[model samples]
Target: MAHILLADDDKATRDLVKRALESDGHKVDLTQDGAEALDRLIAAPEGIDVLVSDVHMPGLDGIDLARRAIETSPRLKLLLMSGFAEELDRAQALKSPNLNVIIKPFTLEQIRSAVRTLIA
Candidate 1:
């Protein structure tokens, strides 16, 4: 099982995602704001293997969070979800081949599949 950091502003989304991941035997840490998420990532204890985040959020956004997280942990894997996926930078979008950007309204299976792909 992998340890995941989930950052999204919507409470429902956060809860649902957390439950889904936990059901799969993964440990999930949640935060509603991007800035807080970044801080947590910076100070996170060991075993945090991946980050799943919404694109738009108060304070820092997901792209900034991903960039900073990568800086903090070069081995960290990222999955960025968004309602408006086009708003992110084109270069960054295409930069990391391992990055997964799931659009909003994704199924639990999709999230699980993405996580499994990264973990595998």
Candidate 2:
């Protein structure tokens, strides 16, 4: 199983995603914001296999966090989520090989599939 670092400002969304990923047999480290996620990634760069983050947050956003994380962990897989169309557009423009953007209101199965594809 892969180690996933999940970041989302919404508590309900974060919890739901965590449970879905965990049910798929992955170990997840949950964070409420991008700053905290970045700190965790920096603390143990090699420990995380994938980063699933929300696009919008109070501090650093998912796109910025993913960019920074890649600087430290080049191979880190990214799955960015956002309900905002503009945010999704920004994520798509990143054009990174290991990065993917998922729109919000997705089913648990969809997220599980995305995570599986990322780690595969």
Top-scoring candidate (TM-score): 2
Question: lDDT value for candidate 1?
Answer: 0.83
Model 1 backbone overlap count: 0
| Candidate 2, residue 19: lDDT | 96
The lDDT, on a scale of 0 to 1, for candidate 2 is 0.93
TM per candidate comes to 0.90, 0.97
CA shift of 3, model 2, Å:
0.2
The TM-score of candidate 2 is 0.97
**lDDT, candidate 2, at 50:** 97
TM-score of 1: 0.90
Residue-level error in angstroms, candidate 1, position 99: 1.6
lDDT of each: 0.83, 0.93
lDDT of 1 at 43: 87
